[model samples]
Target: MQLNVERGAPATGKTIRLIQTARASGQDEHQIITGNAYKPADLELLVRHRISRGAKVICIDECSEQHIECLQRLGGRLPDELTIHAVVSY
Candidate 1:
């Protein structure tokens, strides 16, 4: 899987723009999941579900270190075909 991390200060509209672009491109909103530093397990579950639903890319807004940890834990567990984009807000 390919992981792209976009980091910036909070309320910078990065997440919003990502959502808008995804929607404009006909991607399902469900494929984009909002996350935080505290919800690693939840994020993992959501990613798994999205992949099962045939989503090629999964977007996570407000990502954090915990989210990275979750991804690390899920390393090699998720399909290699998936692409993950994480928008991290400080």
Candidate 2:
């Protein structure tokens, strides 16, 4: 159960690296959480749903204005057995 956050400038491959790092530990079961696909208000519910479905890695895309806030809202809602890799590139 490792929880880490990686952040860098946009287009620096930070997100890709995080995904790869997460996959190294998971069995190809990573969930990509993007703001474009889900509303800001529904991110928590969706992330929790994905996690419950056995998502080992969570990638919070940097394209959303509330990405950081969304990450913060996830404070203590995740399972200890899961690995979270959220990259914020502003």
Candidate 3:
């Protein structure tokens, strides 16, 4: 499962929600790794790692259409082994 949040959006509760849900489900300390990237390579490792660990990948702070487009494109090409959730804020 992957989560992607758009820029300028309030993500105040997203991480908490995931943590709570994961804990309630009896999952171990859900490895929550949050980060940002202006380049594809910068996010590659983290994205792949999360996917490999069966963890959701989230993208936060996407403010521009170009950013959204890049994220969408990347999502489309990501390995089928992973699921992504994206929250875009206009």
Every model's TM-score:
0.79, 0.66, 0.45
Candidate 3 segments exceeding 4 Å error: 1-12, 24-30, 37-40, 52-70, 85-90
TM-score comparison, 1 vs 3, better candidate: 1
Q: Which predicted model would earn the best lDDT?
A: 1
What lDDT does candidate 1 reach at residue 80?
Answer: 87
Candidates 2 and 3 compared: the better one by TM-score is 2
lDDT per model, in order?
Answer: 0.78, 0.64, 0.48
Which is the winner by lDDT between candidate 2 and candidate 3?
2
After superposing candidate 1 on the true structure, give the runs of residues whose Cα lies further than 4 Å from its correct spot. 28-31
Error of 2 at 81 (Å): 2.0
Q: lDDT tens string, model 2, 1-90?
A: 454666677889886776676567653434556546667668767777878888766666653557556656666666777666666666
lDDT of 1 by residue, 9-86 (tens): 888889788787568657867657778633788788878887898877777777887797788778688888877878
Clash count, predicted structure 1: 0
Candidate 3 residue lDDT tens string, 10-89: 66555455555555544444343333334545555566666667654343332245544565667666665554443334
Worst 10 residues of 2 by lDDT: 26-35
After superposition on all C-alphas, the RMSD of every candidate to the true structure, in Å, is 2.4, 3.0, 4.8
